[model samples]
Target: MASNFAAPMKVIAAAFEESTGHRVRLAFGSSGKIFAQVSNGAPFDIFLSADQAKPHALLNAGLAEPGSAFTYAIGRLVLWSPVTGRVSDGPGALREGGYRKLALANPRLAPYGAAAVQVLGSLELVETTRSRWVQGENISQAFQFVATGNAELGFVALSQVMKEGRIARGSGWVVPSSMHRPIRQDAVLLEQGAENPAARALLAFLRSPRSAALIESHGYQLPVSEE
Candidate 1:
């Protein structure tokens, strides 16, 4: 699972266990790192990636079951700070460069970080803010940097700070979709778990209305059902 989905996935896991009597153990990290682990024979039954690319790669590598990959959520990015009102100025804040440090996930490993870089480039602040960058191994750690004041602000997933369609604390600007490519998060059942009934059940449950509501409540856009 992607680190940004940690909180919501916990809820979904609990509900799943309660409804199906199947316990799920989740490991959250950057999608790239997780993909590497899966490729190296990690015991993960399902791969919930932060982007579609990794899941597709796993499919092409014969590491995941065919026809099992699907977009689970569309992520939203935000510039957030634990301190109240620190991010209200939005992209202008980045251009003005008042903050000493800005945290973001590693672009090489995390899709959100790549999007953050895109945003900075769009605002023409990439060079200006080069020295102030504090990169985290994943979005979760990047969020930790801002939450702990290690960085004044960070580009984070909206799911990390939102609850029930509203910001839980502090303030942030939900970056416009036009600012970057769509963050289409996808999930796949690993080939190692091809015969795991629990894994298949979990995938089915994820597409249920109950799970869709939980995912949307955490600020993610649910996939439009074809039917």
Candidate 2:
């Protein structure tokens, strides 16, 4: 699973277990790193990626079951800080650049990081902000940097700091989707789990209306049809 899915997946997994009596063990990381692990023969039963590319690549490599890929959630990126009002002005605050440190995930490793880079590029601030960069291995760690005050603010998945359609704490600016390519997160059944009933069942449950509501409550958009 993508690190961004960490919060919602815990609740979703528990609900699935309670209703179906099936256990689920999840692994979370940058989509790039997870792709490397799965390609190297990790015993994971499914792959929930932060972007569609990795899952499609797995399908091409025969590592995942063909036709099993589907968008599970549309992720939203946020400029956030645990300090209240730090990012209330959104891109303007970024432009002001009074802060010493700006955290983001490694663009090469995480999709959210890539999206952050896109926003910076769009605003013509990449070179201006380069010197203040504090890159994390994944979005989860990038968020931790801000939450711990190591960085003044960061670009993180909205799901990390949101609940019930609102910011749960601190402040964040939800980056407009037009600022970057859509972050269509996709999930796929791995070849190793082709016959695993629990794996199949869990995938079905992820697409259920109950799971859809839980996902949306955590600040994600459902696919158009699901919405």
Candidate 3:
């Protein structure tokens, strides 16, 4: 699973285990890193990527089951700060430039980071904020950097800062979707899982209404599936 989905996937995994009596062990990281590991023969059954491209690459490489890949969720990006009201200024805060550092996932390895970069470029603040950027290996670490005050502000997944469809703590500005391309997160059944009924069941559960509600409760959008 993508690191950004860590919190919610925990909930989903527990529910799945309870209902099916099938224990699930999860490993989370940046989509790119996980993809690399799978390419090099990590014994993973499923790949829940933070972007569509990685899953497509796996399918192309014959690492995943053809016709088993699907868009699972659309992620939202946010500029967050632990300081109260600090992020209410929204993208304008980037332009105002009072903070010394901002954190984001490594754009080359995390889709959320790529979205953050897109946001910066769209706002024309790329050059101005370049030197102050602190890159995390994944979005989870980026969120931690801000939460721990390592960075005054950072771009993080909305799920990291939200609970029950509301901000749980701190302050954040939901980045406008218009600022970047939609983050369509995809889940694929890997070749290693072809015979794993539990893996297949988990993938089916992810598309269920129960899972959709759980995902939305954490601030992610359900994909609009086509008939």
lDDT of each: 0.91, 0.93, 0.92
Put down candidate 2 lDDT per residue, 65-102, tens digits, no spaces.
Answer: 99999999999999998988888788988899789999
Worst 10 residues of 2 by lDDT: 81-90
Give residue 187's error in model 1 in angstroms: 0.3
Q: Give per-residue lDDT, candidate 3, residue 32.
A: 80
Model 3 error, position 29 (Å): 1.4
Decreasing lDDT order of the candidates: 2, 3, 1
Alpha-carbon TM-score of each model against the true structure? 0.95, 0.97, 0.96
- Superpose all Cα atoms of candidate 2 onto the true structure and report the RMSD in Å to 1 decimal: 1.1
Who is ahead in lDDT, 2 or 3? 2
Candidate no. 1 TM-score: 0.95
Predict model 3's lDDT versus the native.
0.92
Cα lDDT tens digits for candidate 3, 27-87: 9988888999999999999999999999999999999999999988899999999888888
